[model samples]
Target: MFDKILIANRGEIACRVIRTCRRLGIRTVAVYSEADADAQHVRQADEAYCIGGPRPQESYLRGEAIIEVARQTGARAIHPGYGFLSENADFADAVEAAGLVFIGPKAASMRKMGSKAGAKELMQAAGVPVVPGYNGTDQSPETLAREAARIGFPLMIKAAHGGGGKGMRVVRVLDEFMASLESCQREAAGAFGRDRVLLERYIGQPRHIEFQVFGDVHGNVIHLNERECSAQRRYQKVIEESPSPFLTPELRAAMGEAAVKAAQAIGYVNAGTVEFIVAPDGAFYFMEINTRLQVEHPVTELVSGLDLVEWQLRVAAGEPLPLRQEQVRQQGHAIEVRVYAEDPDAGFLPGSGRLERLRLPAPSAHVRVDSGVVEGDTVTIFYDPMIAKLIVHDADRPRALARLREALAECEIGGPKSNVEFLERLVRHPAVVGASIDTGYLDRHLDEFMPAAEVDPDLLLAAAVAQLLAQERAARERAAGSGDPHSPWALADGWRLGHAGKRELAFVHRGAPLALVAHGSGGDYRIEHAGHDVVVNGARIEGDALSLRLDGRGRRFRVDSDPHRVMIHDGERRLRLEPVEVYRRQSGGSAGGEDRIRAPMPGRVVLVRARPGDPVRAGDEVLVIEAMKMELSLKAPRDGSIAEVRAAPGDFVEADAVLVTLEA
Candidate 1:
């Protein structure tokens, strides 16, 4: 085994590689960018170095810089942990040229599989099942249009070097073909440095399943089961699971054979994945081959009882195959949910800010959290927003799903918005629970998955009462000097009065206010509101927060809260209460009355579609902003003339930055 290895990536994968390397007694070195100076992965490694700026091109993607770091740290091997330079054939060649082992497939194999078009041709030549599409090298617009027509409408235009949904577009109509083709090419060229694209017939109700394949230098390859990855958004996978719900034993065998064939065709070695699009009729078509460890490898690991990274390192060090295909067996079901720092309500735009509070679910025999961030860590727009991969394994699929749901519910995160609520809803959806999933599942059932109704009066009242009681108890503790001895209440003298003092507490529940009167003293009290009297005991007040026991239920509430707004936690969901003064009118708002265009997210302006005094329509593209490797187009809000173009191409702008103002 290698004595020392350098991880040529950052974030969770880098941290993941470090763990395996340590277990195998291999010292690990980490390289970071300026933005990640105190990143989790950097702190976890034995040695660390700063390569360059925050952007990938200047740091992580700089092969030479990474190689230099490996050399300086005396790392004998370089593990490109997925993304950035992981699939870059040139990077692999450079690592080998520096006399450092590349802990992945051979550079030659990567070169062949890096291009989707080339991979398709190779797969077909190897007698593996491949989708009928145009994989030729013709770049003429006319040829592409012709190919699209031949392939039929509702086709997919994918970048030859695309992954994670970048540089891909799905067109269902002939009229939208040309524009989508051009856009796909532009994005493909910008993202992958390749304008080449391929056309494939869009398979309706398709399920994305990928097989994990591993190989050694001794000409042995084996499959490690399949992962169902159909739960996706924006063409990127969101949730994945092992032992696909739709795959039978017979189908699994066939797919496993095809995965082996696909890997062998490229002389693949180390760890790789063969992705396929399975149709509703049980027919599967080859999608592409990833030439490195996958982001979702944990689910496979959970079921296969093997550390893929360790295997990769061992294989790269000239080790022979340790196990044959017949020896590999899957033990149980494992599901992985990708927790990302994104706003689900805001079209899933990546969120960036300091993680003020973070409470991860405890790991047990069934749960594992692979994370690269901690509380107070800033999630910048410099890289992928994935914060952690939460995986749960159990004896059965239903048990695994239930454990995963519980785990997600226990995950507490604050600061920037995230898709935790959305993920929680998705896993609990009826169709999802029934294992009836496809690419269109989310889009088709969006209305059914809106935030759960807030009209449960009983639950709301219980939450409010719990809050009030907790507050009263905290107040008693403060008065008795039993809590926070430095508190001002501890210094106050208690005076007996003929009549108990009444304090009016107003709280908003489910967008409505409830006025309650606190009666009695300290341990014994009754809260009266809405013609109902609730007995309270053991009430305590600390500062503005409250804790109390009421009617066999434990409730905690915060009062003396923000006068304008208060937040209530009901153990399941958070309720926001705002004073009437701060509430805005929700009805009859003017639509598209101005031409002002705003940047959707913080990013560099990549393209300015219009200039000052330019004529524009209500929905015309005004500019394009690039953030987190995705391009967002800013559009005119109304039909008007462009009065000013405040931002030019290459200028950085923050979220909601005004870019173009329209003249009425």
Candidate 2:
């Protein structure tokens, strides 16, 4: 095996590769961008180097710079961990040319399988089952539209050089086809530097199942069962598992054979995945082949009991396959959930901020966490927002799922918004638990998944009242006149004799304002107009916050005295309150409306579709902003004349930056 290897990537996958390398006694080198200078993966590596700026284009994708780092560090091999330059044939060739081993498939094989159009043609020629669509090299808009019509409505317009769901669109009718086509082309060009696209018949009830295939220099290849990646959102996989619950023994055998055949057809070596779109009718069609270690490789590793990274090292060092196809066996079921720093309520938009706290669930024999971040780390908008991959392994699928759910519940992340609750709901969804999943599952049940309801007002009030009483008790204890330091009467000495005095306290719950009234009493207090009469006992003050036992709920409310913000922890949910300040406003007449276009988030402007004096309708694409590895099109909010265009292509923008203005 190679003595030292360089990981040409960052994030969880980089850390994952380093772990395996350490186990095999191979020293690892990590490359990072400015954004990841203090990242977890950098600390885990034996040696590290900063490649470039925060953006992937300036850092991870700089294949030549990474190759130089590997050379300077005297690394014998370079492992392209999943994204960035992993599937770049040129990068692989550069490594090989520099006398360093590329720890993946040969460059020739990658070239053949890199493009979706080329791979489909190769698969068809090799007699592999491919989807019925237009794989021809025709880029004319009319020609593609005609092919889409022939393939029928509800077809997929996929970028020939796409992955991670970028540059992909599903058009359900002819009316949406042309616009979607243009959008897909623009995104594809921006993401992959390729505008070529292909049409595929959309499978209604399709399950994404892919086999993990490995090969050695001696041409021996074997399949390591399969992973079901059907749980997806926005065409990107969210949860993955192996072995697939829907796959029977017979189907597994057939799919395994087909995967091996597909690999052999392209002279594939090292670790690669043969992805298939398996239909409900038991027919599987070759979607495409990933020419590197997959992001969800941990699931297969758990079931197969193999270190794919170690295998990559050994194979790159000119070793033969250690085990044959018949020798490999699936041991147990494993499930992996990709935890991302995104807000599910905000269209799953990427959230960026410093991580205040990251507490992982205690690991047992079955649970494993592969993470590339920690507390105090900043989640920026420069790359993918995936925080970690939580994997659970058990003897059965149900047991694995149960462990996964428990682990997710136990994990606590207190920084930016995340989809932890959404993930919990997804795994427990009846269709997912019952193994009745498909690509369209999330889209069909979006309403049930994402609900827009305000929190229970009574619960919020109870928490606020509990907090107020606790604070009063603590203040009394700290007073100098109280012989009993913890006496509640110390602070109540100033209460008026005739009637109860009420003080207005402001509370903000879930971004909404609330006014709370706290009435003074000897030892107990009544919350006037509160949804529930919350009684607090055994009050204890910790720092600026107070802890109280209320209503047998075991609830804890931490009140920030200065900000007047209270955090109510009621087991599963948290209620946040910020004091609502009343401000006098000037009375005025109804204001006239004006048209404005704003950037949704901080990003670099990629395209400007309109300029001043141009007339546009509502919903017309006015500009495109690239952020978090995805392109978001800023549309015209209303029918108007373009009055101003402030942003140009290649200009950086901040959140809510004015990109355009329209005249009503």
Candidate 3:
């Protein structure tokens, strides 16, 4: 084994690789960008170095700079952890040229599997089942259009050189083919530096399954079962599990053999995943093979009782296969959910901010958390917004799902919005519980998981009680150092000469102003809001938990608060209450108006399709901004003529920056 290795990626995957390296007595080196100077991975590694600017183009994708870091740190091997440079064949070849071992498949094999078009051709010839599509090398726009017509509507246009759900689109009709093709090509070129695409016949309601395949220097290859990755949103997997509930033993064996064959066809070495799209009839078609470790590899680890990173290290060191295919076992079921710093209600818009309060479940034998951040760390805009990966394991899928729900309840993230509540609902949905969800099910029925915009009367009272108790505690703490600490003046209970006065507070709930009136304090109160009055007693906040009574019923809720908003959680339901000054006036403008288009996150403007005086209809894509490796289309909010275009191609803009405005 190599004495020291350099991790050429950041975030959870980089930190995860370090853990296995530490276990095997290998020193780990971490490389970071300016944004990740004080990142958790940097603190955890034995040594760290700053490569370049925060953007991926300036840092992570600079293969030469990464190679130089490996040389300076005296790292004998470099592990490209899942993203950034992980699947870059040229980078792997360069690392080999520098006399450093690349801890993944050989460059020659990566070359064979780099292009989705080429990989499909290779797989068909190797006797593995591949989807019928256009894999030819004609690069003309006319040729692509002609091929789309022949392939028929409801086809998939995927970036031939891209993976990870970027640069891919599904066209439902021929009328939308050209536009989808252009958008897909642009995303592909931005993400992978390649604009070539391949068309595949769109499989309806297919389950996305993939088998883990490993090969060694001795030309030995083996399979590590499969993972069910059907629960996806926009081609990005949200939930993944091992021992797919939809697969029978016979189908598993057949897919496993096909996966191994696909790997051997390319002389694949080290770790890789052969992805497949499976129909309801047990028939499966080959999806592109991922040439590096998958983001959801923890599910495989939990079921198989093996460290895949450790296997990659040993394989890269020229060791033989750890175990033959028949020796591999799938003991139990495991489920994993990716918790992201995104707002599900806002089209799952990813955000970057400080994690004012991040509380995740503690790791146990049954639970695992792989994250690179802690409570005080900031999730920068320079990379993926994955907060954590929550993995649960048990004797069966039902038991594992129960653990997953319980573990999700233990999570409380404060600063930026998260999908914790959404995930909780997802795990309980009938489609997921019954293991009947397809790849497009989440997107098709998203409203079923999203809570109604209307707030409940009980929730308002709970928020009022929780907020009042929290304020009372702060007041008591302030009075501790005063001369007359016990004086009633320190209290904020609206004390009057003969009767207790109502303490009025202002809050914004569901975008509407809410008036709250509190009648008492000292763990007892009456809350009146929206013509409803309720008596509350025993209201107190301890740390992040709130216990109180509303009307005659006892209530308890989890409280996560920052200066901006207070989030109250009761089971899987959550209500975000923003406290405002009682006398503060409201600010309004067209920045968030129907005639204006604003950037949802901090990103670089990649393309602007609208100019001054251009007529556009509602929902027309007027601008595209690339943020954190995803292209966001800023659409026209209403049918109008474009009055102004402030952002241009290649311009970097902040969150909520006005990109375009239409005539009122």
Best by lDDT: 3
Better of 2 and 3 by TM-score: 3
lDDT of each: 0.81, 0.81, 0.89
lDDT of 1 by residue, 1-664 (tens): 8999999999999999999988888998999999999999999999999999988888999999999989888999999999899988998999999999999999899889878898899999998998878979888989999998998978999999877778888899999999999999999988889899999999998999999999999998889999999887656787899999999999999999999999999988999999999999999999988888999999999999989988898899999877889988899899999888887666778887788666678888899999999989988877888888899999999999989887876665666667776787788888789988887777777766655645344344444444445455566666676656566444322223575555456655434666666665555566676787777777565663456667766776533233344444444444444444443331113123465677666788889988788888878888888887677877888787889889988898876667888885
Per-prediction count of colliding residue pairs?
19, 2, 0
Distance (Å) between predicted and true CA of 130, model 3? 2.0
* Candidate 3 lDDT tens digits, 366-453: 9999999999899877789999999999999999999999799888887777898899899999999999999999889999988677
Say which candidate scores most in TM-score: 3
Higher-scoring candidate on lDDT, 2 or 3: 3
Score candidate 3 by TM-score against the native: 0.90
Error of 2 at 584 (Å): 16
| Cα deviation of 458, candidate 3, in Å | 2.5
Q: Which pairs of residues have clashing backbones in candidate 2?
A: 506-579, 508-578
What's model 1's TM-score?
Answer: 0.85
